[model samples]
Target: MNAPASAIEQLQLGLPELDWITDPNRIQRLSQDFSWFSPVLTRQLEGKVADAVVRPRTEEQIRQVVAACARLKLPLTLRGSGTGNYGQTTPLAGGVVLDMTSFNELLWLRPGLARAQAGIRLNEIEKAAQAEGQELRCMPSTYRSATLGGLFGGGFGGVGSINYGPLAAPGNVVGLKAMTIEPEPQIIELRGAEAMRMHHLWGTNGLVLELEIGLAPAQPWLETLAVFDDFDAALAFADQLARAPGLDKREVAFLASPVPDYLTQLAESLPKGCHAVLSLVAEAGEEALAELVSAHGGRVSYRRTAAEVSKSHKTLMEYTWNHTTLHALRVDKSLTYLQTTFTPGEYVRQITELSRRYAGEVFMHAEFLRNMEGQTNCSALQIVRFTTEERLQQIIDEHRAYGVRINNPHTFIVEDGKAGGDLPEDVLAMKARFDPLGLLNPGKLRGWPVGAAS
Candidate 1:
């Protein structure tokens, strides 16, 4: 990569019409994200301010900026709401940080589909769809603050994953308009299988300009928070709920233990000495849901009727599993997290053992989802109170030693989507075709050419 030119003047002359921020403090702030698991390393990775941070409001503006960067041989990094956890958007090599938030717009909403500008918040688009008696098919825990482009580029399974699967599945993405960094950056619209491949590529393949997604009919949902006397019962209940037929929509499911006092707030009305399982469902399944809880030795501690849940959709959506975990971490100044996936067969026993082993050091918080085979698969995000950075690394190493696949949570990125797949050689060739200069998020995505600086 070329040595960065004088930050302010280079960007000023490169895209004279675009707004550019060169102040050291402001640039530093834009470079980092909400990744608290490894605060010190997070800051290190987000080191140095870009010569300029540019926010483009129109596709034309984005293209113009890209064209100028290509001409100057400057690296460009794309950013959305910065809600990612894997350092995916952090400018490791400072260049022009393209803030995509200003491009927010709801471009189209028709039966079974909705399209919006890359920068639109997930909640904003869902609200517009709900007014038309429809809604987003799936959204991550951070929907309220997460932008559409951010989710497409850097999101994974959320509370609703049990029903809709991961966001990268073909059923979720219908099309996308992206700007590639070939000899001449050009805007291209892709649909069907091709578009699905682009979902969750971590902004490596190209910069998403707009998104067309599949939508689901809006249903009156009932929210329930249940408390279990033991962790075993909570995990079993969640697994049973996932397998239960006639579940209108198992939107969000979470199992929390005492370590994460955040649940103490949501389950405040519950009696002491109990773990909790929270869920959201369509109103029509209330009777059946009650039976399922009873069968698993659990009781609904707090219930929001369909009317209440509907009225509070925006708030409920914002506090998905991750938000709950974030709130708990805030209670303790020294807390970080871990991301791991496990099969449902022995989830209860495995989690219980691990929690007991780590005891005061680790808190167990789980979000349920389904594997590609339709079997129960889950991602458990473990938040641990702060300790030495070396000890934290040891904890992650120990957890992985037990056979769980851990996607280190210290970064703003999550590993999932088609980007995780081994693509055909032609697919790699195609990437080279669009990114001849190898300037797009270089080291990310499958088949991404090697030897490019991350």
Candidate 2:
């Protein structure tokens, strides 16, 4: 690896037209992410940082920069909004950091689909779709700041995931345009299974330029914030509400403890020792939704009309899980999160036991995801707060020993388990075929071409 200053000078001389950042402070800021277990901190402690950072605006510029780096045998890492919880976007080889935010552009929008540049934020795309009476089928909690490319590359389940399914499903993404680094860098367009294979690989196989996604009709939605006296009741009601037929359009199933100040409002409203669940339902009338809640022993603490929701939904992004975690982190800087899947039927009991075991050391926060393959299986995202790094690792170990599968965003990439099994072989094969130089995010992917690292 080259010295940071020397590499920055070399890259500038090679690609003067591309914007380059060499400041040590800025490089330090770019080195880490929201992940609690990021290796960047340790790397920084070792006095190492990315050799250089490049921000390219155009597709040709991106290609040109990659071509140059490939020629120099320098590693490259792609970044979007940097809202990812995993270290997926962190440069491991201390090479070039490619900031893709400047590539923002909306190429096209039809009735059922829309194509956008990799840097476009999810909320930006949603606003455009709303104008056409349509909306994205699903979006992660970080939609406001998260770029489309980042979500496709690193995001897992989100609020709308309960209805439309995970983003990797064939029905969600229509196509993608990506740049490959190999014998010769070239742009290629893929659709169907070929395109879907790249989902959640953390930008290892290729660098995405544009994406086309299927859209859902924009419907009047009701947003409600509710509270319950007991955790079990809240969990039971949430499960019943989520599993009820004809309620496929619930946007979010967020449950949080009373620790955070924001949740303190719910704490004030509910009886002592109460928890809260915030639910957003779309395409349902108020009366029907009210009846469903009433049947499940849920009282609608607060309700917003469709017009209000549409006008404020974007603002609500700040109140979601991602933002909630940011708030919780203020209380405990060593906190880390986990992404796991569980059968909804068994979720309540299992989570309750886990929470009790961790006690004061960890607080459980969860989001309900859509059921897959009619198996009654559901995915839940959990964030664990710890006072010490050792405690964090211990919690992770306990979860694993209990046979709980975890996609630890604090360190490794969080991905769909089913998708992961098939990714390594396919990604390695694709890299061998297209990126034989292994110049693009070399060590990021799980099974990248062996010995291909430059």
Candidate 3:
């Protein structure tokens, strides 16, 4: 529910020059993200809306809104392009949603690094970096619309994660500028690990203003699909490709059997009853990739040269990562997904065993990535045939029993969605220091007591 209209009106009147969206319908629409991806989150976050939205075009304007909200003790939720799936942009406590898209600007670009305002879109940054013969080291599949800040605040890694790991990995995110929640907002500069304290906290710890990120040298990536009749062969090919240090690749995903069938757009390429490994490797490594596919008894079913993909503006990337879930949902509405990490060396065995255990119930879809400790493994975003919430929890528990870590996506509570048990004391302390009154995304961080001050 929205806060009192009078309060929102008062905020608007105070900042008469600021851009405000007061239309209830538009406000409601802007209040939501892709959280509807999960039936559980859909139900829990139902009817949650921000009282109003403010689109600040300048850093000065943002400070004004921040100060006013803090003085009024109003809950504030920071938002970007709203591409997140876990209700990261949803305002659990009705107040103000600070829309940051207008604040976008590519601050500067240097060799192996670039800095940009929090609202800059990932694609925009990539295009700019590409002009400099560099590209983002890691970005989500929704890079075209997802903002740099949105990815930093709520995203793990995607696409290029095989080489760089997640956004939280050391050196990926060099530094950031954040604003504390207070009447007199303090703009702080945090570097290295200090800046990452706010990472993946769902924007509950502090408000990020700008970020400096590392970049990878540009490559002409060849997008292809290696199809195999045998599921084990497909998994092995993807695993080998991920572990092959000599083959330069951006992405490697295994879509087993029925999972490939769900990608209707790629139906022609994804032959019936075949497991597929979608990959993005350097154009120069095409012959090597083909050799590996043949070694594993598979065939290249689809091929799109970098130039063709660039001209057509279509790539297999749109059909991998969480995009796979989206396409599957489009084809079959009765499906949900799980976020899981398998034991590194045992990933293939674990996936093989689980596929047998669940078979038709859980469709195996894995993305090969390097973990924080630089270990090679695959994180599975398995598509499940949703029957009931109880059954979903059971599936998660069973996976945990099999030694796979499940990061529950169904919960809006920051700590609950995480794989680890509870928020670290340092994380809680970060929240207290940056958001003393707990006014920033109030209900999302369960560890903080409401209205508490440092």
> In model 3, which regions exceed 4 Å deviation?
1-5, 449-454
Q: Which stretches of candidate 2 lie over 4 Å from their true place?
A: 1-8, 37-48, 254-256, 259-273, 310-317, 374-377, 387-390, 413-423, 446-452
**Candidate 1 at residue 121, lDDT?**
95
Q: Write down the lDDT of every candidate, Cα atoms only.
A: 0.72, 0.69, 0.92
| Model 3 weakest lDDT span, ten residues long | 445-454
Q: Write the per-residue lDDT of candidate 3 for residues 150-218, one digit (tens) a residue.
A: 999999999999999988999999999999999999999999988989999889999999999999999
> Each model's TM-score, in the order given?
0.88, 0.87, 0.97
Instruction: Write the residue-wise lDDT of candidate 2 on 1-454 in tens digits.
Output: 9666564466679788788887878876675566543332343334435788888999988988888777777878788988876666667677888888889999999999999999999989988999999988888777878899999987765767667777876678899998887436789899977886778777777888999998988876677766666667777677666766676554545464653343433344445445666667764556666776676666777777678866755434355556666655655555555566665567777778877787665566666665545333445455565455566567667777876666555544223333244455665676565576776665565554323674
Return whichever of 1 and 3 wins on TM-score.
3
Candidates sorted on lDDT, descending: 3, 1, 2
* lDDT tens readout by residue for model 1, 1-454: 9777563467577677887776788787777566544665565574544666888888888888888777666667788988876666666556778899999999989998999999999989888998999978788778878899999887776756777777866678888888887437887888877776555656766778999988888877777777788777877887778767778765545555664345445546456657767678788999999998999898887888767765665445444556756766667657777777775586766777888899877878777776666666677777777677788778877877887777666633323322133655555655665566766654445344333633
**Candidates 1 and 2, the one with greater lDDT:** 1
TM-score, cand. 1 vs. native: 0.88
Clash counts per candidate, in order, are 10, 1, 0
